[model samples]
Target: MNALMLLVQKLSCDVEEHVFSEVSLAIEKPESYFEKFKERLDERGIDSPIDQLAWISLVDALLDHDLAFELDWKESGLYICDVVDELLDRKKMAYISWGDFEDEEFDELPTSQCLNEISGKLKEVGISLAYLDIDSDSYVLITVPSSDIDDIKKMAQEAGYSIQDSF
Candidate 1:
């Protein structure tokens, strides 16, 4: 199994939210969607960092699920509201996981225990573990406050986990 890590800032919008808001718009206007969306988000008082890969993954996932409205970008905009409503109804956050470990290696990976430990440690510092993506290879993608990133890294390191700066 391949062990990889990514240091990502948690966005205010989850997968569903991002898909409805940004992805939908981007699909309709592929040329300058991000710039426009960023401007809109700024106006709305949201300052979360946007990850292009995450958005691409969301679009792909939507397409794979046959949730994409239509091939014509112009008509695609019509489904934005519907897609947002449907995804909101599902109430699921989007996350990606990696790793292909054997049953025996499951316990050796960063299991719930390790995550709970990290969560507790972070909580003490006033940082909540909002979301997590972990795989059998001990690769972890954690979402926490950007301000607490360094602290979280230190704690993870002290707990015997190596932090990779990127994927």
Candidate 2:
């Protein structure tokens, strides 16, 4: 499904007006590949969504005590993992009317929707959340460049993903 792509519009300096940038994330693993990854979370006793495994992967990738400090969310009174939990809950409540979603809190969203919400929140710091498939085993995080390119690049590089200005 073309569900992994997000279209972003930009006012180009050279263009007549606007141009479209495709936010095509790269997740370089098969379904079975995640089982090993899930073990890491399981060892830590963290339960996350299955349908949106990509979302869980993002949470694992970005979860850090220093994240709130680096992102200036420390004073926002929540840890990165805490924000992630709240986001999952918000999605659950938002889709509580749907029988399928209501049946399971963690599985309340499609991957695209979850990624979109995370992207929106990241945008607050001039970063966009996405996956970049760097190898055959797992997904690596990436960002869409904005006014905060330097910080974004550092984060992506620290996460060990190649930086791309556009998809």
Candidate 3:
């Protein structure tokens, strides 16, 4: 699982070039970590296989957002929580998902106002704000850098919720 570990490490370390390069290489080489059918279709300029592009785009977005962190992620690992995940757990996060809302309807939602409201609410609970997606009506994810897990759990319990480990 070195490849998977490498991907996770790159993500945890916030190694931009290395991560992008690995993903690009994975796209090109068709490793066990990634499916190749989509890659092949991509190279042919066919539009049917979109998951490859979507996954790549998602990784790009994650890396873009990670640039905001002041600390080194490689040393930190994934022990720190992503801000969007926090908001989602609070039920204060919103996102456009087929399971919930459609893309067009989600686009019509008041995102800025919603983000502000969620931010304020999370702040009250001693949680920090991270990322919010208005167009998709989704919150990215957030985590306390050095906060106690017990305390965070307490806060979530107080809100009549529970926290789950994220992948």
TM-score of each: 0.24, 0.26, 0.28
Clashes of 2: 0
Which model, 1 or 2, shows the larger TM-score? 2
lDDT of 3 at 87: 28
Q: What residue pairs clash in candidate 2, if any at all?
A: none
Candidate 1: segments with Cα more than 4 A from true spot: 1-22, 26-110, 132-140, 146-167
User: CA lDDT of 79 in candidate 3?
Assistant: 20
lDDT of 1 by residue, 1-167 (tens): 10111211122223445445454454456545646555544643435444442344333334434333122222222132233234333434232221222234433433334344434444454444422222223222333444655654554355334333232
Whole-model lDDT, model 1 = 0.36
**Candidate 3 lDDT tens digits, 1-167:** 23333333323344555555545554455443244345543543544533344234334434444532222222221122233443244434343222223234433445444344444544556644443121222333443322443444444344333332221
State which candidate has the highest TM-score: 3
Local distance difference test values of all predictions, in order: 0.36, 0.36, 0.38
Summarize candidate 2's per-residue lDDT along 1-167 as a digit string, tens digits.
22221111111122212121111121445244355565755754545434444434433433321111112211121222244334334323121122222234324544444445555655665544444433323323334345645544445455444333332
Residue runs of model 3 more than 4 Å from their true location after superposition: 1-109, 132-167
Judged by whole-model lDDT over C-alpha atoms, candidate 3 comes out at 0.38
lDDT of 1 at 6: 21
